[model samples]
Target: MEFKKFKLIKQMQSTIKKEFIFLLFAAVITSSCRKIFNLPKEKEYLSNNVNFANKILEPVLGRTNLIGGFNGDNSTQPIHFEIVNARYGDGRPVTDIFQKAQTYVWTAAYTGTEKSLAEIEAKRHLEEHPLFEIRSSGEFIMWPSATNDLVTPRPADSTNYPQDTRFFDVKITNTGGERLIRDFQIRPWRERPYDPADDMNLYTGGPAPFPETPYNVLSRNYIRPSRMDNVVGDSTDIDLGNDNYHRNNVLVYIRPFTGGNGHSLRFKVLNKDSVAIDPALFNETEWVRLVHGFNLVKTKEYVQYDVAYPIPLVNLSTIYAPGGSNAYIELKYSRTGFGQQRVTTVLGLNFGIYRAGDWEIVFHFRKDNPRFKDE
Candidate 1:
C-alpha cells in the first residue's frame, strides 16, 4: 500500500510541472507576437523629418515680410510698400513674401548719416569704391505727393509742424533682379502724443496718432502673402509678372540707432498651400509607382534649434511646390534684446534670403534709412 501511494504522489507532481512549463511557453509566444505586430505612430516618426526641413529652410527662405503698410492717422490713408521679386544667386526664386515685406519695413525704419556731396564723394573714393550693383530691381516709385496737406493740430495749438512734412510715393521693382515690383508710400516721421498706458496704442498709437491712439505702436496691416492668381510654381509659363512670390520665415540681425546694439529677428508665418505627404506613400512597394507619377526628390530632413527653453522638439512642415508652382511659407518672430527688453529702435530689422537646396547665406541690408536721414 505504501509503495502504491508514493508512485501516485510522484505522478501528480510531474503533471503540475508540465502545466507550469506550458504556461511559461505561452507567455513568451504572446510577448513575441506583440513585438512583431506593433506599428509606430506615423506622425511622430515623420515629425522629425518635417522639423529638419524647417530648420534648413527657415533661415534660407523664412525671415522677412513680403508686403507691409503703415497708417499714421485714421483720418489719413496708410502708406503701403510691396515686394515685387526676390531670388537667390542660382536663379531659383525665393518664394516667401513675408521676408520681402520685412525687408521693406527695415528699409523704412533705417536712419542714415547725413553728409555733403563732397564728403560722400570722398567716402566713396576712399571706401574701396563698392561695386555698384542693383541688388534688387524693378520700380520702387513713391505714391501720393510728398506735400499733401493733411489734418494736423493748428500751429497756435501746437508748434509741431514748422513746415509741411513731405510724403513720397515710392515703388521697388525687380527686387534682387527676380523681375518683380514693390511699391511704397514714404513720408516724414511725424510725432504725436503717445501714452504707454492707452489701450489704443496697439495699432496706430505713438509718433503719429489720432484721438484713438493707444499706448503702443498701432499695427497698420498684418503681414500677409498676395492673392494674385499668377503666383503658381517654378514654371516659366506662369509669367513672372510684376507680382512677386513672398515668404516669411527668414531671420535678420540689425543695428539700432541710439544704443549701437544689434537684435536677431524673424517674421511671422501666416499662410501655406502645400499638403503634408504621408510617409507610407514612400513604401518600397510603391517606389515604382511614385517614380512614374511624381518627380520625387528623396524625402530629406530639416531641423531647427530654439534659442530658449529646455529645448523641446520643434516641428516644421515643408510644402512641395512642383516645378512651376508658387510655393511659400510664412513665419513671424519679434525682436529680442540682450536683456529681454523690447527695444523701441525701429531700424534694427534685417533680412537674408537664400535657396532651400543650397546651404548658402544671403544677406539683404537696407540701402537707405528713411526716418532719420533727410535724403
Candidate 2:
C-alpha cells in the first residue's frame, strides 16, 4: 500500500510537469504569432480586414432613395445613376455645402417636343422604373454586385426585369408577415448646378466660378420615388387624361380656380383608410402651379409657389387594364442629418391607367411658382 501511494505521487508530478511545459509552449507561440507572423492569438476572432471600423460599423442606417433602397449619402458625391435633364452631361460643381445627405423629387412631364432624348425613351415607363415598398425596418442582407450568385433569379418566380446597375439587392422581413426584396442603390446627391439662364437671372455680374472650384457646390440633395406600400391601396397613384381626339400624352396645368374669387390649391389626404376610392379626378380642378426648379427650405412653415409651364412628352403605362393592379407613385424626399434624417413623402395623384389625356393629377406644391406662401 505504501509503495502504491508513492507511485501515485510520482504520477501526479509527471502530469503536472507535462501540463506546465505545454502551457509554456503555447504562450510562446501565441506571443510570437502577432510579432513574427502578424497573426492573432488562437482564441481571437479572425478577420481579413486590417481596419476594424468597417466591420463594427456595418448596416449603418441612412436615408432611402426613390426606388425603395438605401442611398449613398456621402459627399465628394459619387453619382452612380443618371437623370436625363439637358443639364446632366455638363460638369457639376462639387462642394461640401451640405454636411448631410438631402433628396429632391422633381415630377416632370415630357412635352411632345422634349421627348427626343434616347435616354428618355429607352426606359419602358413602368417596367424599367423600379418600384419598392419598405413596410417595416429589418436587417438588410446585402449582395455585393448585381450579378453575384445571390441575385440569381428564383427559378419558380419567372417575373423578372433587367438588372439596374445602379442598385444592389437587399431583402428584409417586416413586422407583418411579408418578405420584401428591394434593390438598394447607393449614390451621392449633388448640389443644384448653375444654369446659363441663371446668369441672366441669378447673377448678372458674378464671375462664373468654374465647375470644380467655387461656383459649383457638391449638393447633398437627392429626390427619389417612394417605397411601394401593399397596405396603402390609394397611395402613389397619378392621374392620366383621356382626350382621344387630341392625344396629349401628359398634361399639367395651373388654371385659376374657376368660379371662386379666392384661389386655393389645397391638398387632401387619400390612403388605405379613405372612405371610398376617388375616381381619376384631374380636370380644371387639379392644376399644379410650379416654381420651376427651385430649392425648398424645410421648416414648420414650409414654402411653395405657383405658376404655369409647358408640359412634357408623357409616357405612362396602361395601369387600369382588366387584370392589372393599380401601382403607386409615391415620391420620397430625404434629408440626411447627423441624427435622424428628415423625410417628406408625396403620394402620386390617382388616375385611370387605361385612358388619360386632359386628366391632370394635381401636384400639391409647385416647383417654380413665382408667388410664395408658408403653411
What are the Cα lDDT values of the candidates? 0.24, 0.26
lDDT of 1 at 72: 21
User: TM-score for all predictions?
Assistant: 0.15, 0.17
TM-score of 1: 0.15
Candidate 1 accuracy as lDDT: 0.24
Q: Write the per-residue lDDT of candidate 1 for residues 1-375, one digit (tens) a residue.
A: 999999999999999999999999998888787789884422211111111011011010121111222222221112233333333334344332211111111112111121232332233221111111112221122211111132121232323332322122223222121111222212222121111112122323322233333334552212112222222222222322223312222112211122211211112111122222232321222232211111233332211111111000011121211221121222112233347653221211112221111111111211211111111
Q: Rate residue 224 of model 2 by lDDT.
A: 15
lDDT of 2: 0.26
Model 1: per-residue Cα lDDT at residue 95: 31
Badly placed stretches (over 4 Å) of model 2 are 1-27, 32-246, 253-375
Residues 123-152 of candidate 2: C-alpha lDDT, one tens digit per residue: 323221112222222223221111112222
In candidate 1, what residue range of length 10 has the lowest lDDT sum?
51-60
